[model samples]
Target: MVDNVSKQERSNIMRKVRSQSDLENVVSKALWKKGIRYRKNVKSLMGKPDIVIQKYKIVIFIDSCFWHACELHGRMPKSNTEFWESKFERNKERDAEVNKHYLSKNWNILRVWEHELREDFDGTINKIVAFIEHAKK
Candidate 1:
């Protein structure tokens, strides 16, 4: 499928997309209100997770439904189907690799989907807190 815009224009548009999303900020604020301390995208950690509770050795990933290819909400771009498919495949592969790395180090990873957060933000926050509490035990 051909893109309507020039390749350079498309590249510029893509570059304008924010790397960090609001989901991360929402979760961060929730945790802060509860007095739970966390680091955002720690460079030293594998995959640089969205949130990290060093005390609990827990890592949180605020996954985008579109980017992660969520079973319910993910869709391939009609304009660049092949390119998008390959990109999503690589993303899934990288996610798997990161999971393996964390597992080997006995770290707890919680991947929350964008749709899940949007549908029930409070519930999602509670679940993350619960996981952290459980890890403490």
Candidate 2:
């Protein structure tokens, strides 16, 4: 499918997209306030996890509903349906692969959906804290 924008324009637009999202920053700040120290988007990691605590071999992923194709909240775009579908499918596949890789290495993996955080921010943060604490054991 041909893109609506020129290749250079599309590249410029895509380049403006930041690796770390505001949602991630919010969650990370909350976790830090709770005294949890972690690294964000470690490029050396297989999937460049959103949060990682090497001390506990833990990794947390903050997934967006649109990007991760959340079962409850995900929706297809009216335009470029096929491209979006393929992109989402590949995202899901990569997520699965990353989970498998971490699990094989005995790393604790937590995937929090965007809606989960929006619906219950405190609860989600607590869950993440609990997950980290449990991994400490």
Candidate 3:
């Protein structure tokens, strides 16, 4: 299917798309305000988790619904359906692999979907807080 916009316009729009850590920063800021400390985008970790509390051995991932194939909100693009489907499928497979890596090491992982944060910001924050608290035990 042909897109409505010109090629250049589409390129420009895609260029402006948010980088991976944009949502991660927002969540990190909130956690900071709550007096929780964490490291952002630590490269040593598998999948480079968005937020890491090294002291508690906890890693947090703020996954975009579209990218991570959230069951409720993930929708393949109308155009390039096969391409998008394969891309998302790979993403989910990689996520599961990352989870397994951490789980084997006895690390606590908290995955927060984009929609979860958007639909209930405070609730999402509370959930992370609870996870941190529980992991501390």
> Model 2, 114: alpha-carbon shift in Å?
0.7
lDDT of each: 0.90, 0.94, 0.89
Residue 90 in model 1: lDDT: 97
Order of models, best TM-score first: 1, 2, 3
Using Cα atoms with residue i matched to residue i, what is each candidate's TM-score against the true structure?
Answer: 0.95, 0.93, 0.86
Q: Which portions of model 2 miss their true places by more than 4 Å? A: 1-4
- TM-score: the better of candidates 1 and 3: 1
Best by TM-score: 1
Worst 10 residues of 3 by lDDT: 18-27
Best by lDDT: 2
Cα lDDT tens digits, model 2, 53-107, are 9888999999999899999999987756798999999999999999999999999
lDDT of 1 by residue, 6-81 (tens): 9999999999988788878888999899888889999999888999988878998999999999999998888978
Q: Quote model 3's TM-score.
A: 0.86
Steric clash pairs (candidate 3): none
Ranking by lDDT: 2, 1, 3
- 50, model 1: CA deviation in Å? 0.4
lDDT of 3 by residue, 7-55 (tens): 8997899898866656777788899999998898889989989889989
